[model samples]
Target chain A: MNDPIKDFVEQHREDFDHLEAPQFNLAGFKASLAQEPMVKKHRILNIKPASWMAAAAVLLVCTIGLWFFNSTQQTKKTEQHLALNKQNKHPKIAEKPLVKAVTQNAKQTQFAAHETTSHVKKHQSKEEVPFIPSPDQMLYTKLNDSASSSTRLAAVLAIKKSELISYDMLDRLAATIQHDGNSNVRLAALSVLEKYRQDAHVTNLLVNALNHQNDPMLQLSLVNLLGKMQNVKIDERLYALVNDPSTLEAVKDEVYQILLKENKF
Target chain B: MKLQLILLFALFTTGLSASAQKQYKLAKNNGKLNLNISGVTVEGYDGNEIIFSLPKNEDEEVDERAKGLKAFNSSGFKDNSGLGFDVTVRGDDINVNPVSVANQPKLSIKLPRNVRVSFANNSNMYQDTVTLKNLKTEIDVAVTGNDIVLTNNVGPMNIKTLHGSVDASFPADLKGPISIISVNGHVDIALPASVKANLEVISNYGKIYAADDLKIAINPASNPKTNATGQPVKTLTIGKGVQALTIKSLAANSENQDENAPVFGYEGGNYAESLNGKINGGGVDFILKSNHNNIYIREKK
Candidate 1:
């Protein structure tokens, strides 16, 4: 069987050797390669390495500048706060941050600012430079900031001596009468406000203060103040005081006396 | 040699005993002491340091088992002074606070005569009376339900008490801007008859009494016309050319009116009355206010 296969291959060897291979076609192969999809080549930006380093440096500088500017603004604000506190003769309040101090007294500050702006506008016909806080304004800040009762009392006394007491000052004094922790300070403020008792706003403030005050002395003083005015508006408040169980008997007696004088009892 | 050794031992023991007293050196001038503790006696002496000591309690037996261990409390303070007080000094201010509320030992504090003292009793449970003696400087005290007694003090004092009495006696030359206020308690103040000061005594739901020795010239309540300046102007001329005292009785309707009047008029009422006057010649302000109690102005003997 191996001899037969060898004879066949020997007979076919001449034919296989005579058979030629197909012709090669370079242009056709190239055309077929062109028909296939082209792959994208990654190209870098046409920027220099030094330029990139410069851009990074500029970014770093901008970041540092922004930080420095913010810090400087904060420092300036702190210095301004310190200067204002010093003007009030309270050196201790300078220790706290300006944001904390303002936010803590946001309501009082807003009232004072509004009052001061209106007061300034009323006094000045022409537009002036940025408003500088008056000495009274500085003292108003101290009235709320000073922790010592004696200092607050002194501040009130100083305001009492002011030649021209503005409505804003009266408003602040009224607020002190309502909220000051020390009764002595509240009493002093009440005495000062009594000078302007004829003003409707001052009377309204006194009536409102009567509701918040629990001290017997303050309550009696308020009752007497309102009774002297003979304003029928405070009768309801006085009646409420008489009906409330927490009202001191002394205050109720004063209210009754006032009502009796008015013939409303 | 034996005798020498015995002498050395005696000397060493003496030194140890002397060093056992707890003391803190304070500034010689303008020093301040702040004590936020109760159940203590504060006495002023001629010393440059704040010396404190705890009284021995015979009833409390020693615990032998806890001898080696350090004591700690929930307040996170150790017994550093062995006097149940943690005293910290910042600049010229000395702050003393109790380490623990439980088992508070009786403390005696000796302060310099010239140093200012501020005492506060914050504990509601321990409302023991505090006595301050021989203080020659500013005294500021605020307490709750604790009676205060000040003796031999020449003060610019501001004292406030709630549900407690105030008894203060000043020297002949009393330096004052003295204000004493009490709520639901009596206020008794004794000043020398010759002292020069403007005094205001206010009592709500109580009465005001003054001694006969005090030459108090009562001024009539000012009318609206008299107070034209819108300020309270009180003028008095007792015997000579001296300012007058204004006695305001808001409780004229009360039922208890004393018929036998001593030196000043006594009208009884639950309402508040304010008496403003000057003694000798007006110099400093001395105000005494009491709510729900009587006010006694006595001439110091």
Candidate 2:
């Protein structure tokens, strides 16, 4: 080798080396391009003379290896992305809507709102009315609103007009009490319901507030409702609470009066 | 609105002023006091008659001012005209002048062709017994403050009194829905053996003695019904028969009447004796109701 070639090889030696170890096709590459294109006897060739061919051949092999490696890496990434999508995405996403029968079946077995929640676009129900005083507002109106007074007054007047009660209105009143109204309005509602204990959910609501609600006055109204209902279901449920001692005298007299009316006196 | 109220006040005031006239009456025929009032009705074969039962030794008196039958002394006929009527120059003091109206007194009158008695002048507080028999057409009789006795053939009878016992002899055949009432008196009725007609009787006080054949029924109360004071009411209808006999008695039961009998609808029916009202116990298809009274049902054979 010439001195210039030797110097060039020594200086740029690492660039020509592979990280794992210099890899190359010495026989196939060097031998082919070693002799002239016409010389048959001279099989081996000098690398210095075939530097361009050697470099070109190496570059071509690297290009092919890089293409295969990158193609394989892309395939593996695709498989991983698919696996993650399968594992992480919710199962419902693949579902086509229940053709027609499922839609038809949704109409029945309506469950109450705020009850038995499971993720389903269940029936959209009329808002749960509170069991309150008004026939329309089953739930009590929130006293927090400025209009609650007027609404509550309207409810009272409507209640006074007749004895028949609408349970839905009571529910609304209950809801209003739970969410909107002041304790006082709710207490008033309870007083109005004093005569009716057979009402469905309202009594339960009143019973629930027996201890927890802040309003102390509501207890009396609740007791009044419980007693007047005359149902053993209610009266017996609540142990006898003596409210008006003076009434005991009247009750004794009442027994006499009742006996007299019965002609037993 | 104020003006309207003022007008209503004036209208009521005028009505009150108009009702201020206290009623007064005079006799018109020959009776115990010679009063020819239509209250004395005849049933069969007898004409119109005016009668008055006088107290023993209380000479039958005559009020000369009575519209008719004056001349107690002037007539050759002794003051004792020997007529069915009696008269005394000096008679008992009568608060009212009893007289029968010249014309019909807007009353139901049944007069037979044989007997005829018109309005005459007389004085009397009560006529114990009065009969106009053989009445076929019509008759009108009125009496006040007196115990009246009426007997006649099947004709309409309207008897009224202030306070006295009423013994009305009605021909069993006398039909036309009999109605007997007393403001304060006992009503004794004799129904004919065979008769079917509605009867309505009322007495402010006193017992109801009726013929023994009337039936009783109880009325059912209507739903959402109200008593007198807007309270829910339970009503009763008691009695039955061809006649819708409605008997309303505003009578405070004497000791014997309610002694042991459980009385319904009468607790509130007893009227104050001062009220001097009536208890009704006879009628057909009639409604008998009294604020205070005792009602008895009787049947006629």
Candidate 3:
């Protein structure tokens, strides 16, 4: 069955050999192989730009949403704090603005000083300057707002150690002596006020404190303090105390002794 | 059968009434207890609740007329605790006030050991003494005419009374910053021998008595110089070049010992107008001040 096809091929063999086979071209094949990737690269480049923009838009939206949520939470926390402070009716909370003003002034002073200094000095001083609550604020808050009597007593003692006694601080001390429920705190306040006994305002405060004071110890202290003053005009008040039935016998005796010593009896 | 039922009903009613009057207890987790009512004896216990009850008297009987009726008076406080007081709890603070000021009862309060206590009675009509016992916390007491008796307490106590005496007995290990001021009454404090304290006793017009066992070191006056008139002079050194001279009278001295020594009556103890000394090398501040009454500091036996 194959004899006919074989005979035909055998007959065409000389013709096929006489025709030259097509020459092999390596450079063209290499160029075509190189051009295949360029088309794939262009296709990839054309597809990526829109996806990148969409991803960037999502990131920007997420960041804004997070910032907005954080700011709202902060505002809510501040509102809660203010409301709680109002309910507590604590004077220290109410005086936060005063404290802030004092800190702000201190910061301004530091800023002014920094302006006059070199960068190195500024950095050194910034590290050195710590925010300390002013003595006035500390005394005011502790004396007025502290629930512990010992803390108030400590505040009075601290005021006693301070070299400078402001007029406002004196008034606060006087108020403490007059109105503080704890006798020890009142006594401590009295001791602090004794330093300013020579001042007319303090003398008046002391003289007036005797009438409102029912504690025999406080009355005695007031009498003794006022009696020691050089020109205090408390003789009439002393007589009044002697006449007042509410005044204790011990206080009356002290007043009498003071009057006798002064030759005003 | 009817008789048996009647007997059972009577028994149940009696039990109910008995249980009703037993005690008023409020569960508490250690904080402060503010007692504005007088005539209360506060004792610390290990239980985690506050118990308020009237002191039992064998001869006392409940008023039949007061049954099913709350105690009412002009004080305007309702007896919510069923112990003749209005007990309110705010946060961790428990406040106790008498329902009727006119009918101030002798209440016994058993508190948890960790709770601090503050008692204040400013009314002159309520002169019943207040007692605190077996407490190991800070105590603040202010009363007008009622005596304060403290026993077996370790404290950072501040007790002030206008005309009331303060008698305090401390445990062996005394914690302090203890200040007791009685305007016209005596202050008697007994501390164990092992206690270490800085004791400052001031009796302006009275005497200070101390037991012999306490080893007290009296501090010297800042300036001991006396002027020509025999008045004590205090010379304060001011700034760089200033010396402020302050003349204080002998009468101002809390310890006018020289003048009062002849009248001292204690047999084996020391007596002075004022005494500022350290007991057992001085650990905590203990101040006792009285204007017109004596202060007695003794060692606990």
All-Cα superposition RMSD per candidate? 16.8, 39.9, 22.3
Q: In candidate 3, what are the lDDT values of residues B201-239, reduced to their tens digit?
A: 666657666776665655434333332233443433211
Task: Please state the CAPRI-style docking class of candidate 2.
Answer: incorrect
Better of 1 and 3 by DockQ: 3
Comparing candidate 2 with candidate 3, which one achieves the higher TM-score? 3
True contacts kept of each: 0.00, 0.00, 0.22
Candidate 2 stretches with Cα past 4 Å from truth are A1-265, B1-43, B46-128, B203-212, B217-301
lDDT of 1 by residue, B58-157 (tens): 5767889977665666766665666667777778787877777766766777888877888888566877777888888877787867899999888767
How far residue A86's Cα lies from its native spot in candidate 2, in Å, is 79
Give stretches of model 1 more than 4 Å off: A1-148, A151-169, A178-183, A191-199, A210-265, B1-31, B65-77, B225-270
Which whole-number lDDT from 0 to 100 does residue A119 have in model 1?
A: 69
Q: Which window of ten consecutive residues has the lowest lDDT sum in model 1 chain A?
A: A81-90
Tens-place lDDT digits, model 2, residues A155-206: 5434533433344445555554444333334544554443333343546766
Question: Top model by DockQ, which number?
Answer: 3
The C-alpha interface RMSD of every prediction is 12.3, 32.2, 17.7
**Model 3 chain B weakest lDDT span, ten residues long:** B238-247
Q: RMSD of candidate 2 to the true fold? A: 39.9
Model 3 per-residue lDDT at B99: 82
Q: State each model's TM-score restricted to chain B.
A: 0.75, 0.42, 0.75
Model 2 chain B weakest 10-residue run by lDDT = B270-279
